[model samples]
Target: MRRRKLSPEERDLWSRVAATTQAIHPVRPAPPDDLPAPQSTPKQKPPPPKPDLRDFRIGQSAPGFVLRQDLAPPLSERLAAGPVRMDRKAHQKMTRGRLEPEGRIDLHGMTLAQAHPELIRFILNAQSAGKRLVLVITGKGKRGLDEGPIPQRQGALRHQVPHWLHLPPLAAAVLQVTPAHQKHGGSGAYYVYMRRNR
Candidate 1:
């Protein structure tokens, strides 16, 4: 194959530019054959020091393993930890089952769609009728077949009711909502204290 020859001006420009540049990777010298060949095996870090197992028994936990704890507190603890929005003394009595609920609504066996509007209507009517406290019974949810990747929490309604009570429509009429006392249904129901209708 014939090579294209550079013009005189082009050849001059190439020589000038090439003179200013340094080789990024200069050619390396060949190693002597008499010396041992360089090992191809890459240097590896020492395996993480084996955990001390001298005293470990067959069933004992491995050293440095921590007993896992739940990241979030239980639902009851979270509710009790919230700041008091109602009168302190009355709040105390209400939680202790001393204040009786004037009206009760059992919302068990209903889907979320079926239960929400009913709850709103019940709370609104109770407030207008001069009720002070009411019971919202969202039975402790059943353990259904958990077929999804994420683990499901028991009591869908139980967890959702409190969140619903805090939203605008119900939040206006509701003064406080707490898990019910044992006689009133324990964690299965809630004591919903109503604000004055006016």
Candidate 2:
């Protein structure tokens, strides 16, 4: 088939149309300068401070603490005298029987090596006896006392008691264990709560 070619005038007309289209569609300029810039609002103030915990006092109603003594038979049977020497005011505060728990136990005279087995037995026996809590006292070891001039190889019973509490037999019987309060035996004692025996 034969084709027809555009004359010069026709070509010139097409070019003019393309140029006119581009000019009409010139890129829109950024929004007019009359619009204001965005300003952020100020931050709100924080709420007032909470009460200081240091100012709070432990109430007489705080749970009673016990000292576990390791003394043998007759000596072990008696409850250890309260280690804390309370002032007259403090003593009066305890007159209401507010600081006593259900029971107490003492482990003071026994070494860890000896006491470990007794501790296991006590937990089991305490559970069977329907006792919920017991106290175990492990004295702050022979720190200043005479021993080899250099620190001896002897272990600290105070530190060893906690380790025994974490052992399998004792841990299984114990539901929870915590350090005794000051009026009890303080850091030298622990309060052991036993799981109910099935």
Q: Pick by TM-score: which candidate is best?
A: 1
Candidate 2 lDDT by residue in tens digits, 60-151: 35433433443333211222233333343533433322345456656677766788887777777888888766777776556444333343
> What is the alpha-carbon lDDT for the whole of candidate 1?
0.89
Candidate 2's C-alpha lDDT?
Answer: 0.61
Q: Write the per-residue lDDT of candidate 1 for residues 10-105, one digit (tens) a residue.
A: 999999999999999998888898988687998998888887658757888655533344466767887888888889999999999999999999
Q: Which candidate is the best by lDDT?
A: 1
Candidate lDDT scores, in order, read 0.89, 0.61
Candidate 1 Cα errors over 4 Å, as ranges: 1-70
Backbone clashes in model 1, listed as residue pairs: 141-155
Query: What are the clash counts of all predictions, listed in order?
Result: 1, 11
Error of 1 at 58 (Å): 31
The 10-residue segment with the lowest total lDDT in model 1? 62-71
